[model samples]
Structures are given as C-alpha cells and as structure tokens.
Target: MSSQPYRLYYDRMTSAFVPHVMLEEMGVDYELVHIDTGVDAHETEEFRAINPNMLIPTLGLPDGRTFGENGAQLVMLGDLHPESGMVPRIGDEDRPAFLQWLFAIATTGHTTIRRYSYPEEYSTRYDAQDSVSEAAYRQLTRFYSVLDGVISGEPWFLPRGFGPLDIYTILILIPFEGDALADILDTRPSLARLHAATHARPTVERLWNFYFGADA
Candidate 1:
C-alpha cells in the first residue's frame, strides 16, 4: 500500500456514499474532501482539473492520479483489496453473477435514480419535470422488482455474501428513504430485507450517521 491515504472528493447524498461505505468497510486510510454541490463546487475549473467530468465521488490515489464514476471506482477498490472479498476472483462460481449485478445496479439502477432525483436535467421545460420524474420513478420500481426476485441468498445479493453490489444498490436507494421508498419496500419484501440488513452493519450505521445524520 502507498504511504499516503486515498482522497475522496464528495458531496453529501451523492453517489459518493457508495465508495465512502466501501472505503470504511475495507478499513483503508482515506481523506474526505467535501465539495458543496449546492454552491456548484464540483463545476469549478479547479475541481475539473481533478476530474474533467465534474462528477462527485472522485477518488485521488496515492500516486497522484484521480478518477470518477462510482462503478469504476468500486471495481478499482475491489481489485486493490481482494482480501475484502468485495469482488469475486476469476472462475469463481459467483463471479459471473457478481459482474452482472454490479453493472446492472451501477448503470441501469443509478441512471433511473438520477433521472428521478434530477428531472430538470433530463428536460428543460418546467412543466415537463414532473412527468420526467414520474416516468423515472415508474421505471425504477420495475427495476427494483427485478432485483428483488434475483436475490436468492440471505441478507446479501449473492451466495458468497456481502459485497459491492449490495453497497451500490443501497446507495441509490438511500435518496428515496423519506419519499417514495416505503412504497417500493412495501411491495418488494426481498429488497426491503436487503436494505435493512445492509443498514444494520456497524460500518453502514456509522457512515449513515455521518452522511445523513444520526436521526436519518
């Protein structure tokens, strides 16, 4: 391991939470650099130098390299800390399922949540925002249902146990907690069980308090 700690640029409640939990779970030394998205800190030229895409959850490595995107970061971290078992090794029975769920949650699930959360980004018309959000929400529900059915293991997505797929799934779901989440959980008991189990972890509980407050 490098002598310097990894640096994570984040904004509260963003996709940054995924890697935040992963880093904590891995027990690696890392520093949190908060970028206030409310003030558009992520859009500034200075921040762009770190990550051209201006996306949060940008990770700075000890070797002076930085990268963004939650899915890519999760893969890198898992490879770096194979002992954590966040990613299954080649030829492992769970490896195929692991890759499938990881990308499914990261791309399809993440995109749907993003569309629902920020509908204005999908459309410029003020009157159309609600429609965009509603459409996204409906799609998200279907996606979640599919995931709920695929989960055949106890407390985790795969038979091998807890890994990045659970973290990615829950991170996207967190934003819906006080809103329409209960409705989603009401129908998908499997997903609800996974949510509860993920949050029940000591690391997850502590990080939840830090990012969403103790009451959250």
Candidate 2:
C-alpha cells in the first residue's frame, strides 16, 4: 500500500463490489466515498467533475490520478501488485486467458446487467422496455452458462487459484438476489457451488452483512 490513501466512489452491490472486495483481500488501507446513485448523486456536477462519465466505481489512486471503467481498474491494480495474484504475471501462459475472461465480463456480462437493470437507458418506449430487459436477461443467462462450463471442475475461475478476476466475476452475480437468483444458480451447478464458496469468505460475508443484513 502507498502512503497516500486510495479513494473509491462506490455504492453497495454495484460495480464497486469487485474493487471493494479486492482491496480488502489485498489488505490495503483505502477510503470509501459512498455515492447514493438512488438520489441521482452520480449525476450531480460534483460527481461528474470527479468522473466525467458519471459512473459509479470510479477510483482515485494514491498517485493523484483517477480513472473510470472496471476493466481498467482491475488491470491497473494488478499491475501495481504483480505478486498479489490479482492477475497472471505478464507473459505467463495464463495471462491471455485471464485478460480474455476479464474483458468478456466487463464487455458482455456487465453491459447486459446494465441493460437488464435499467432498460429505460436503452429505449424511451415504455412498452418496449420489457422487451429490452428480457433480451438482456437472455444474454446474461448465456454468459452465466459460458462461465459455468469454463469453471466446471475448478474451484476458481482460473487454474492458478483465486484472483481479482474471481472477485470481479462473483460480483457480477451479486445483483441477482432472491428467488430469481436462486433459480438461475440452480441450473448452473458449478457456478452455484462457486457462489456459495465465495459467499462464505470472511470479507465477502462481512460486506454482505453490512450492505444487505445478516439474513442476506
């Protein structure tokens, strides 16, 4: 960890979840700037000034630089702590696969989730919103299935054991709460097992309790 404190603009269960968990796992001291997107906090000029794109999960590093985009953050963190296992060492055989999966989640899975959660962003037609959401759901299901098949017999996303990519992937499933989430997990046995295992970790469980209560 650097002498200066790293700052993160975050909201519970949002894309911020990944870096939040990763920071804890890395045992680094950081500050959380909780953004209440529910009240359009992210749209305010203050927030927009920090992140021109007005996205949550924006990060300000100790070096006095800030960045948006989850995939970029992951790579930046991994580069900072190469020995931390957040990513494969550069030029390693697993490096390509790790980058591939990371980008896939960021591009395909993350976008579909955004569409599913906020269909109005995709279209102004009130009646067509349901169709947009439904299409997003279908795409999300396929993404989950692809991940399930890849991690069929493994305990982690990569053969090298748990890393930042696992944290990112697990956070991808956090929004699918309640029975809808359960039903989807049931169909993907391997993913269900992974979710359960990750959920049991101390840091993850602690965050769950803090954000969603003990029962959650």
Clashing pairs in 1: none
What does candidate 2's lDDT look like per residue over 99-206, in tens digits?
888999999988888899899999989999999999999999999999998873266777787776677777777658889899989999888877887787889778
Candidate number achieving the greatest TM-score relative to the actual structure? 1
| Candidate 1 ranges with C-alpha deviation above 4 Å | 214-216
Query: How far in Å is the alpha carbon of 82 misplaced in model 2?
Result: 1.4
Q: Can you write out model 1's per-residue Cα lDDT over 1-216, one digit (the tens) per residue?
A: 568999999877677888999999898899999999989999999999999999998999877799998888988888887888878877778878888888899888999888998898999899999999899888888999999999966778887777788888787786586647898889998888888999899988787777777543
Please report, in order, the local distance difference test score of every candidate based on alpha carbons: 0.86, 0.82
Q: TM-score, each model?
A: 0.92, 0.90
lDDT score of residue 22 within candidate 2:
76
Q: Which stretches of candidate 2 lie over 4 Å from their true place?
A: 212-216
TM-score, model 2 to reference: 0.90
TM-score, candidate number 1: 0.92
lDDT of 1: 0.86
RMSD of each: 1.9, 2.3
